[model samples]
Target: MRKRVTMCQWLSDKIDDEPEFLDNMWFSDEAHFLLSGHVNSKNNIFWGSTPPDHCLQRPLHSVKCTAWVAISTHGIIGPFWFEDDDERSLTVNTERYIQVLRKFWVALGRRRGIDRALQWFQQDGATPHTSDRSLEWLQQRFEDRLISRRCHPEWSPHSPDLNPPDFYLWGYLKDRVYEHNPQTIPDLKAAITAAIRAIPREECRRVIENFARRIQ
Candidate 1:
C-alpha cells in the first residue's frame, strides 16, 4: 500500500506539471477471451434427487484468443489478437509483444495522426513487458515517458486499479462479450471486437478522467 501510494503521488505530481499527461498516455493491457466464457458456478444447482457425478471437465486444449487493447483520450488502438504466423492463438512473449506494438501501435498511430514522440506508454509489469529486450524497444520509442517497471515514473506492482483498462475497460468488455455466450473461438473474438467497437469515445474520455482522479 505504501508503494502504491508513493507511485500514485509521483504520477499525480507529473500530471499536475503536465496537464496533457493523461491524454497523451496510452494505457495498455491484454485479456484472454475463453470459449467457455466466464463461468459463475454459484448459480449452478443440481435439481435431481440423486446427486450425479458433479465434475465438469474442460477440454485439454480449449480454444481461446488473447486480445490486446491500448486506450488513450484519442481512442482505442486495437483489439489486436495475439497469434502465430500460422494464425494459431499464442501466449504473449517479448518478441510477439514487440511485434504487436510495432504493427498495431505504429501503424494505427500513423493512421490516427497521433505523434509517437508525445505519447506516454503505460503498461503493467508483466514478464514480457519487463524483459530486457522489450524495455529496450519501449525506451527507444517512449523514452522517459514510460509508466512501467524499470522505466521513468515506474508503475507500482499489482496496481491494476491505477490503469484505466484494468479498472474500467476489461470488465466492461468482458460483461458485454460474455453476454453473447460464444461457443467457438471465432465467435468469442467477434463478440469481443463488436463490444470494443460499441464503446463510445466519450466513455473513453471519462475513463481517462477517472484515471486522473484515481492517481490523484
Candidate 2:
C-alpha cells in the first residue's frame, strides 16, 4: 500500500505537469470523470464498495439503479442516486440527476459550460445511455451539448489521476459508516448522505484534482 501510495503521488505529479495544473484541467475543460456504478441495497448495506466476490450479482436481485451522477471537474455534479431499475417513475433520484446535469448550462450559461458548447462529456457506455429512453432524454435535454464521449470503461477506465472519488469518496464512506454497520437500509442511506455532506468541498476538489496525477 505504501508503494502504491508513493507511485500514485508520482504519477499524479507527472500527469498533471504541475501541482495546480490538475485542478486547472478540470475547471478549464469542463470534463466529467465517471466510473462503474455503485451498488445500494437493503440486506447488504455495507460501505466502501462491494467485495470482489459479490461484484456482479445484480441480475439476481433485479434491483433497479440508474446512472445517477454528475461532476464539474471543478466540483461534484448534483448527485442523483437511484436503483438500476427502469425509467417509469420520475422520482427525485431521477429528476435530481437531470437537474444536476441541467444546472451546468443554466449556471455557466455558455461561459463555464464547455460541455454545452463543445458537446463533450466523459462517460462509460453503460446500457442506460444506450437505451432508447435515456438516449432520447439526453438528446432533448442537452441538444448538441454532448460532443465526444469516452465510451469504453476499460480504455480510460477512469482517470485515476483526475478522479478523486475513486479513492477519497469511498474512504470517507467506509470511515464513517463501516463502524456503524448501519443495520437498516434507511439508516445506511441517511448515513451515506450525511457522510457525503460532511466531506469538505475544497478537500474533495483537491482530491479530484490530484487524481489526474495518480498512476495505475
Model 2: runs farther than 4 Å from truth? 1-67, 83-120, 132-136, 139-162
Worst 10 residues of 1 by lDDT: 37-46
Candidate 1 off by > 4 Å: 39-61, 111-113
lDDT of each: 0.81, 0.42
Query: Candidate 1 residues 1-216, lDDT tens each?
Result: 777888899988888899987778889998776677643322234588787777777766667788899998887878887997666799899998998888765655575666777888889999999999999988887788888987767789878777888888887887888886888777888888888888888889999999888877
Clashes of each: 0, 19
Cα shift from native, residue 89, model 1 (Å) = 1.4
lDDT score, candidate 1: 0.81
Model 1 clashing residue pairs (backbone) = none
TM-score of each: 0.86, 0.46
